[model samples]
Target: MNIYRHEMRMSLRSMLYWTTGMLVGLLFFMMMFAAVSEEASVINLIVSQFPSEVVRALGLSTLDLSTVLGYYGYVFMFILLVASVYALKIGISALSEEIRAKTADFLLSKPVSRNVIVTAKALSVITLLALQSAIYSLGAFIIVDIITGQPYDKTVFLLINLSIFLVGLFFAGLGLLLSVSIKKIKSVLPVALGIVFGFAILQMLNQSLADPVLAYLTPFAYFDIARIINARAYESAYVISDAVLIVSFTLLTYIIYRRKDIPSV
Candidate 1:
């Protein structure tokens, strides 16, 4: 409990920064929706001129930019990217920071077991992410209501927003696994950004190539916004994949962390 509290306190500023950035970005996108709604057809025409592959890669091929939900879907790509980065950073740095700062010796010297320490840090990251997702959802609802002045499908809206959280979880687990698996990490940001963008680029390839196999390579491809909006639910296969990924990586992280050697300070 003490470790959890300390981790949360250390992470509070970062949590606020990410939440504020997401909220501000969502508000800015929603504000633009009004103008875009008016000129949707014109914008669509302009978009149509772009290559079909490019349109699909950008997640604009099948979506209608005229509607609030459609605009939200497009803006969601950016939101997901940012959210994934946050999750990955949290996961990568959760334990690595102790080692990087040469505080692992101090932390391990305590009476608590390493398992407890890892659990507490992991919980702190998950709690912070859940809070951010909840706040972002509320802000999205309020912004959409104000901008569109029409009630969107609540079910679809929730599912769409929920994907952000789920993707964050998957990446968080992956990040944790990597943090423990690696021998030494001098800097986490570069590695985290590389992994996040690498997966993102894979997703773009999946979109452009329309390959089923590539979808399995990236968590971002798991939740298709178009399918969610149309079917009003997430695809079962991807949901199961997400569950498996999170569980597998989390277990692996615990296993490795429990036995892994910590360098003497």
Candidate 2:
């Protein structure tokens, strides 16, 4: 319990910063929807002139930007990217910090076993993420309501926002697995950004290529906002894929973290 509280306290500031940034950015984007809606015809005409491949790669192909939901869908892509980064940073740093700070010896010298340590840290990360998701979702809901001043489909909005949480979880799992497997992570930000952006780039390529196989390779492609908006629910296949990724990586993290030797300080 001490470990869990410590870990959460350590990450609390970071979580707050990310939450504030996302909230402000989302609200600002939502506010712009009105201006965009006022000039929808002109904006659509300009967007139509862009290459179809470019539009698709941007995740704007199937969306109608005039509606609040459609604008939210487009903005959701950026939100997911930022949220993934936040999750990746938390996961990568959770275990690696002890090693990086040369404090693993101190931590391991305690009465608790390594498994307990890991469990506590993992729980802390999960708690932080849950808080972030809930706050962001609530803020988005309120902002959208204020901006649109019309009733939108609550079911669809919830599903679309849920993708942010799921994607964050996937990246968090990936980060944990990588942190355990790698010998050292000199700096968390560069590696996390590289991995997140690399996969994001692959997603863009997959869209450009229209390749079903490539789509499976990137978590960013796992939740299609267009499909979610259209179906009013997440696609079953991708949801299953997300589950698989999260479960597989989480198990692997525990296995490797438990068995791996901590370097002597």
Q: How do the predictions measure up, each by TM-score?
A: 0.96, 0.96
Looking at model 1, report the run of 10 residues with the lowest lDDT sum. Answer: 62-71
Per-residue lDDT tens digits of candidate 1, residues 1-265? 9999999999989988997898899888888887898999999899899999998888888788887778889898889889999999999999889999998998898999978988999899899889888988998888888878976788999999988889999999998999999999888878878999999999888999999988988999999888889999888998999999999998999899999899876
Off by over 4 Å in 1: none
Clashing pairs in 1: none
Candidate 1: Cα lDDT at 91 = 91
Instruction: Give me the runs in candidate 2 sitting further than 4 Å from their true place.
Output: none
Candidate models: Cα lDDT each? 0.89, 0.88
Clash statistics: count for each candidate: 0, 0
Estimate the lDDT of model 1. 0.89
Clash pairs (backbone) in predicted model 2? none
